[model samples]
Target chain A: MNKRENERNPVETPAHDAAHDALAEELEALRDLFQKELDRAKNAPDDAALPVKDGAPDAPPDADEGPVCACCGAPLTDADADAPYCEECLTQMRTRPVHAAAALFVLAAFLLAAVGLYLFSDSAAQWRQLFSAQRAVQEHRLLDAADRYGDCFLMNADRDSVSLTGIKAYADLCRSLGDVDLAALLVDARFPGPLLKLPWNARYRALLKLQAQFAATEQVAIDIFGAYDDYTDAAVYEDVDAQLCALRTDDTYAPVAVEYIRYLLMKAAGKPAALQMQQLEQMEAVDDGCYTGYYLAAMIELAGETGGPDAARTYFQTAIERNGQDQNAYDAFVRVLRRQPAPDTAAIFSVAQAAQANAPARGKPVWLRLFAVSDLLRGDDAQALREMQLYMTACYEQQLSLTMEEWNLYALCAAAAGDEDACAQIETALGSAQLKLSPVIGRVRAGTWTAAEALRKDGGDIA
Target chain B: MNGIDRVIRVLTAPGVWIRSFWVHLLCRIWAVPVTETRLFQNKATFGHLQHMAPPTVGAAFAIGFVPALLNRLLALLLFLSSLLGLFLFRMTGWVALSANTLAFWFAFSLYVNTYPPAEHARRMQTMLRGQGTRAQKILLAPGTFCCAVGSFLERRGVTFLLACAGLAALVLWQGALFAAIARWLPNLEG
Candidate 1:
């Protein structure tokens, strides 16, 4: 810490001394490795010496000289050999190129090979093609998709087969095209493998047109008959008929499906009553009864020909047994009873009352309104008021439109029941409309919608 | 060992086989001159100096002989194109001549990369005052010149003959350097 010490060489300081000690340790380690190298050299063969200035391989050894290499403990090879290392030690110590550079070269070569494989391999190309084809399908690029798909299939077909996904995609393509010929061809190529679970029967009726009889499968028959809706054009009648004929032999069609098929055929061909009855009997003999209120309503066409209201009553009972929620069946049965020569007034009233109690909040039976309105028409003021109150309350809760006429009927029912308060609520909602005798709601469309065109045109003004 | 000792160990670790070289350079204590170093090392032994002279001569001869051998080998590999102009008196003789010229020029560049070691060795030796004997130069100069020639011949299409010639000379140069090392470098290591 004094000036004298400060002026001295830094190497003598504590820190420098520690560094020197570390350096000595490093040298000692290096020397150990050098010693090993020399020992290895000495064990090789008899030592050879270069002819020195003395011109004598057997020159007299210097008395003061000792071993040159510390480890070998052998005599020095030359007169002034001051090197601590022997020949082998020097060989081992030769500097080598940086290993990181060499390793980088190797890694680069490996990546180059990987990139080459991806670029040039057939499988990689096929994978890319398949990917492009899928992209094209998503973008609705049908031509590009077809081209890429064709290339992909051809690429694989030469050696293997299209994967299950590829086959499924082809099936999907056929379905999307919806051309009978194309569907048949592609479906035949794909089959039960891809279609085994995917709307099998619907797709079959659509794509399996080769035999026309494919429609006959109970599944296909169901799909064909059920195919008609406001959203889709009806399936071909010939296809439906062929499938129906086929379904007669197949036992898979449930009774409801057969009844639906008969209903469709009756509507399609305007078949005789006897033919429909025969079909209904055949349907009734099939799968456990699946007839619902919809089916019973369809059966209402045969009502006058069969056992009259009794037959419809039986159908309604069967429908209730099959699907207890068929309020439409309940409504239809009440209608049939009310239409009878000597109407079962109590039965109709009770059926209407029971339907009101049974109706769910959403999709309540369409005929519940029918029964209430029919009761009103029959002048059973108390029962009509009760049923109509239940129906109108539901209409309000369900956000269903109650055509202007329906509101007036509700108001009339309330008046008949002497529920001035209920009539007041309706009048208030209508903004003081005095047209309580309006016949706007004389009939309703099975309660599918409550709003009639006039109410919409009148901007929902019940008045 | 302090830091100085560590540095000394590293500098000396390659084994100062020719320790006298350092003393001659740094201590201003010169070894026998290039000519007399070998002679004076065994000046007392009459026959010892005699033995050294022959190897130097042999090394020079071998150095010269190597290039000649390489030249002939190249001649042979040249598809005997070099001989075509010598014998064929055809009107198209100039064509083969031109081709031989182009081939030699192109093939010479193959040695451009191989010349640096000889040039570096010579430069280092002169810088360190450890110049070897004439025999070393005899070995080094031809390869360096051939590499120069080869580099100039770039884009002429490789002449396998000249390339082989340069490589052979390079090998000869290495051999000569080794001989000179044993003879003169004994006292030059720093």
Candidate 2:
């Protein structure tokens, strides 16, 4: 491998030739990118021409000559005042003792305008980029967009009263990117003043609520937002509740409503009247409003918080009355009713009637469903068995999806129904199969479940 | 020689030489505005610039006059609020301790007038020019803790109990340290 020998056959040394070829290709690619970028730069609308020294169009190009300076197009020379300026005009312009102050003012104005335009264009570009990035999350692109947005804010710190139309989009983009904390920080900065007054305050509240639910930070949330009624009381008088109520289904509003409810409970923690109001409002959902059963169940729990056993029973009755078609609500109401020493026996009978009537068609299955299991623990074996049949019919007949929790509930119902053989078979199948018991179920088994007292237990060992 | 003459000679001689050396060194260092410099090319300068109080009260005081009673009161309030927030969040003593440290630095740097801003600026310029860098990331700075503390205290309902107690301890310890150090080496300003 002598130097002369290697140089003698440039074509024969395949490896070296290939290496050089690769380098050449890489350089060509890089050059192409640069060319493309340069073309873009050239094509970009030139603002520099907008405010010319005298605000007049530069002199036209000579018909026979190459492109010349639009201003004072005496034969353009590289050494002329503007370089592209005509010699005669260049000399005249230079001799005017270039008013340093005037020139500086113009320069300052130009720079200011340029900076403003640059910032506007950059922000617009960032918003567009963020939109596209969110549509299909590319982490690096999103991060780049975030950085650009941050730069814009930092650069324009002087304009503290900037609008947030673009920033909202940026925050939303951050949310989509799963940078919730960053999105929140941006929101806090960009959305100035008290958030409670915004039209989208409800939605913001809803989002905060959802976040609270997801993060289990409801207590902290309550501390920050104050009581819902207190916050909403004045607003409600102004028909704000109507607006908020209308917004309930808006993805933005749903989380806020849930949050408002949670906050309401927090605020009413020790106040009896406020606590009752929380129950009453929730029961209104159960009574004649849409999606009242969930509210009714929540109300019952809230009632318990107030330590009003009678109020809890009344709310449970209201829940059953509002949705007799929902057997689960009827059953839950009955179970809660049974726990109250001042039980409404008449309501229980009526609820049982509704349950039996609403029981699924095509007969129930052999496995005890969770509803049925709850019945058994509530000292209602017949209702429990009936629910078990419904579960089996849904699973075996309708081929409905049954999670491990459902399966376990079914197995328990079977064991409670004194079908030891059936219970053993279900248990063995469950144990052998990849029946993933949910954390809730595992916690229940381990005596660590939230609101476990609401879950009726007590079943014998499976055969 | 008289005692006064000896003292004056020592003071003037050292001060003149040091002042001349620092001025020459710093004039070259601060030739360029720091904000225009890139972070990577001037890491130390960037760090110092970034951490440079963005013309806030603390920044002004740290390099300016001994913080007035009002400023100390304000700083004390902030220090207390930071501690209260930590306590409400059920944080350990460390957070409160950190907040107290912030208060002390504010008092020492601003109230007690340890380092003059003019002197500090000159020193910084020299360091910046020599090393071509600023401070570290401002977010990871003691200044952040101070700012956070100040803001926390400014919020409605935050008291100054914790801050005042911390300030008392800090002033005492600082005085003791100054006295001890002065015995052997003498005071720079004196």
DockQ (Cα-based) per candidate? 0.01, 0.01
Tens digits of per-residue lDDT, candidate 1, B78-144, equal 3233222111110022333354443333223212211111222233233223333566656555544
- Model 2: runs farther than 4 Å from truth? A1-293, A304-310, A338-350, A358-387, A403-408, A432-463, B1-190
Q: Which regions of candidate 1 are displaced past 4 Å?
A: A1-259, A272-274, A289-297, A300-305, A357-371, A380-390, A399-463, B1-190
For model 1 chain A, give the 10-residue run with minimal summed lDDT: A3-12
lDDT of 2 at A35: 100
lDDT of candidate 1 over A19-62, digit per residue (tens)? 56789999999999989978877776654322245567666667
What are the lDDT figures for the candidates, one per model? 0.43, 0.40
Q: Model 2 chain A: which ten-residue window has the lowest total lDDT?
A: A6-15
Candidate 1 contains a number of clashing pairs equal to 14
Tell me, per candidate, how large a share of the native contacts it keeps.
Answer: 0.00, 0.00
Best by the lDDT measure: 1
* Chain A TM per prediction: 0.34, 0.32
**Per-residue lDDT over A47-130 for candidate 2, one digit per residue giving the tens place of the 0 to 100 score:** 843345565467544465654643554565555323334555433432333223323432433343343334334344333332
